[model samples]
Target: MPDVEDLFVEFETAAATTFRPPGVADVQRRIRGRRRRRGLLAGLLAVALAGPASALAVAHRADRPEPRPTPSVSPSPTGRLAVRTVTLPGVSGELAELRFVSARAGWALFDTCAGADESAAGCRRTVARTVDGGVTWQRSALPAVPDGRVHLLPVDAGTLAVMTRVGYLVTMDGGNSFASHPFDAPQAAVRRVFATPSGLYLGCPPDGVPTTCDRQRVLRVSGGLHFHQPPVTLRSDAENALVEGADGRLWLTVGDDDGLTVVTSADQGATWQEMPSVPRAARQLVLAPDGRDVWLVRTEQPNGVWRLAGTGWQPGPALPDDTDGIAAPGAGLLVVTSAYGGLGFVTGGGYVEVSELRGPLRTSDPGTSVSVLPDGTVVAQHGRTWFLGVGRGVDRSWLQLS
Candidate 1:
């Protein structure tokens, strides 16, 4: 089994190689005329050095200012970020979570018994992976578990921290093989795993009893496998989504019967700060790549209004109804997935709906997961299939609704 350090090295190497270096020709082209003059002057200077007249010409040319290197202008990844969807055929239930390590590689977890008939054989929990975008998906063998839920956190491009109802598993070689760890909490069922720059924090029941809901805890896993003491206790039940902000803070939606609560931690799980009031039940919470920006969507309501909240928990804008998922596609633009399974963009004026690239998706389908790659590709998922949809460029204007 490869260690986490090895995985980190691999991720850095992949990132460096995947991103092509800026083109030097474009830069030279920008200063082509100046470069030509400089080259001519240098040649004349060489001739002058060979003879008395050549020396005089060389002095004149030397007085001329040297042309600055042409500013290299590498065009940002262009075109509408393509969105593609791949449906896993054999999966029995709705997918609970979706995550991507890159534009071409990702993973999804579907419920095993969600749509199974009591008389029929129970559906097995499913985990599927894609290496070439979402064109094709292959089911990865999951560890033995009669009833379990899978949660994956991508540590890097080729490494993931996997959690099942039974225990924690680490995959260093992408999703090819998983090694189970001996670490186990009283509550083996982990709802979510938040991977931060520091370590992994798991949300689980404090005492293993669902009925004893008050005793919920956030287990902090540091040094990769070292266990920390006195888990971070929350006043309400934590939501299934956990995201680490770019500001080195951990953010998550925690709610019980009351309402939604957004919490932030600057010191890993050692300390936490809670938002005053989110105003609605949060079905999902996502942190922008910048880390300070956040978007929370309400799932229980049919209106599908999403509250754009972040930083100090101050509200930004209210998204239009029917917005099922919200994602930051770089800059200030917010890409929203509608309940009808269509895509749209939210601007200061209002929500501008994009053409439905997929289908008349079922409302019961788990809220689509949206992710924007470094190259500006917009990848979304509805249940078993992942979509590589059209891109709208990296600039904010390009992302504006048409």
Candidate 2:
């Protein structure tokens, strides 16, 4: 495991910074739900250095048969960024989460229950990972991370935790050694878990329960594995995302059958308030270049893009119907719509196409995943596979990563 200072220095020394956009964009794109634990998240940084030419060798502890990965690695000429694909041998589709600790080290968790609740019949589960910058992969059996949706968060360079149906699955040495930490709350089922820049959090009462009627509260989970509710109430209606910006400000979107509610918490999740100027139907929010301003989308019927202004959410521009892939990194927003394949950014109150999506995507599959690495690498799911766009602006060439 890399030490704290080592993680910082390694990540900071990178010529290309890691990009972490809003969580809503992640959810909209159906990729990993959380990103950016700051210092704790250093491993996910895509180091500018090219990876080892030889494939890394990883073997499971036991004689258990492990899945094989065919990693394609290549170097670039001079100033270009090298891109490669890591094929997860046993991953048969239901890709739940991908937590790339670095350009080389990454962890992935998969559960094919397909949105089943905690009480439903279990599904196939596997925890696959790469230690040498995705150069090679070794997979082993995973404990029931039965949430259908799981979140992998790095506690440090070598340690990462997964929130699942049973409890928290923790690994101390990359993704090898494992420990189970239960939610030490009464009745303790977690609907959602969030890894903020400061700490970890859980949405109480779990999912499959009546999210609208049941009590939904945000509980702070400590490093000691204890769960304590925040001084605030959080709705766990499957759409809420606690969006934290570079300045540490947080915007929470809690929605249900009734309507939507947006709250802001300045000091992490200790307390909250009904933040005005945000939509009641907003499923996600992101900070703008100014840091004070925020942008949101309804994502429901009559979907629209809005910006916060003067104590209220004002309509900014018309969102292309069925927009999903969302990545907002201050400079602007990178978004994709279902109808026109308009993969663009919000500019001067309207969406401007930045790159033409290079895939045959169906009209209904408004891709629910988007990722921006610190080095300005943009990742979006075109269909079952992922496409990477390099560099800082609209001049992006796409590369497919499986």
Candidate 3:
């Protein structure tokens, strides 16, 4: 028999000869192309120290589909809020955003490279609706456009504010049909759309052409398609998240070529107040229902901590573990899903300490998003689908978490 040490050396020699390093220039080109494509789609849109192949494996795990596992539970005497993981049905591509009008009725915006085909606009892009508490989902056909990204804001049970990569559309009759609003721009990218009590706030970046600087402004719409006010120039950058507080103030988080910027408007979006630098790479900004607190969830790690900077810009507290995403249940309550494992919550001023509600559901590359139902049930979106977990009951059902 061959010696074990000799066999191991032979195996290592064979593996080294078989493997070849990827060219750095080739990878750089791919990264640049992806960035340009993402910018054209919407200005709004991660990391591991592993090798390229291993990193891809990790990313695939983060974005993989798996059977919903039973969520871990942490009992608290205050029982202030309960957090759990919910899984929903997802299509191929990736889920961009999720919103719920009630516990059962909700809408999700999905984007995919498959839509690059000209046959069907939704071939790659879809707006999925769930009527039965995310148990199932039905895809709705959106108007065709060049890019294949959709942004949806549910006005009420029957109305929807829909924006595509090409332009804006609205449906008053539950998305069966849509009325297209023509806006001139090479790329009709919309970063964030907010349905405020006052009206609808549309955050769009500047046009693709560098000569025309006038197109970079936030547009306000009221009573369906009626243009209520002229566009407001908040930033030359693209806004990622548009959130409204119970106080009726509008908060906007904009991302430019440089970095992330925060601005607030107390009186609708007519006027704006620029806040201190958020100083991080952020994908989205969410405001608590009370409107007194603000949370910034960074897109990268190490500094991926959630910052609570409002009334005054100060670091609130980091999450219990490193997370790639975050969601607000209400004021002083936040749901954080780790990029590694687990879902937990942080509460109170000074934002001290975190308690895990569910630890690592064995999900691959968890593309997580959480929304609180009117009943306070926390629904989470992992990749292309959603799942629901009982807040205080410890009964976690894998109903679509969209």
What overall lDDT goes with each candidate model? 0.42, 0.43, 0.43
Q: Write model 2 residue lDDT over 264-315, tens digit each, in one string.
A: 6666655666766444445445444224546665545555567777567777
Model 3, poorest ten-residue lDDT window?
A: 52-61
Whole-structure CA lDDT of model 1: 0.42
As a TM-score, model 3 comes out at: 0.55
Two-way lDDT contest, 1 vs 3, winner: 3
In terms of TM-score, which candidate is stronger, 1 or 3? 3
**Which candidate leads the pack in TM-score?**
2
Which regions of candidate 2 are displaced past 4 Å?
1-83, 88-97, 101-105, 109-157, 162-168, 182-193, 200-214, 223-241, 268-273, 277-283, 287-293, 309-314, 339-342, 349-356, 360-368, 371-377
User: Model 2 misses residue 80 by how many Å?
Assistant: 11
Query: Candidate 3, residues 300-326: lDDT per residue as tens digits?
Result: 433443445545555555554355435
TM-score of each: 0.52, 0.56, 0.55
Error of 2 at 69 (Å): 38
TM-score, model 2 to reference: 0.56
lDDT of 3: 0.43
Off by over 4 Å in 1: 1-99, 108-156, 160-170, 180-193, 200-213, 223-242, 267-274, 278-285, 296-315, 356-377, 389-402
| Displacement of the residue 329 alpha carbon in candidate 1, Å | 3.6
For residue 295, model 1's alpha carbon misses the true position, in angstroms, by 3.8
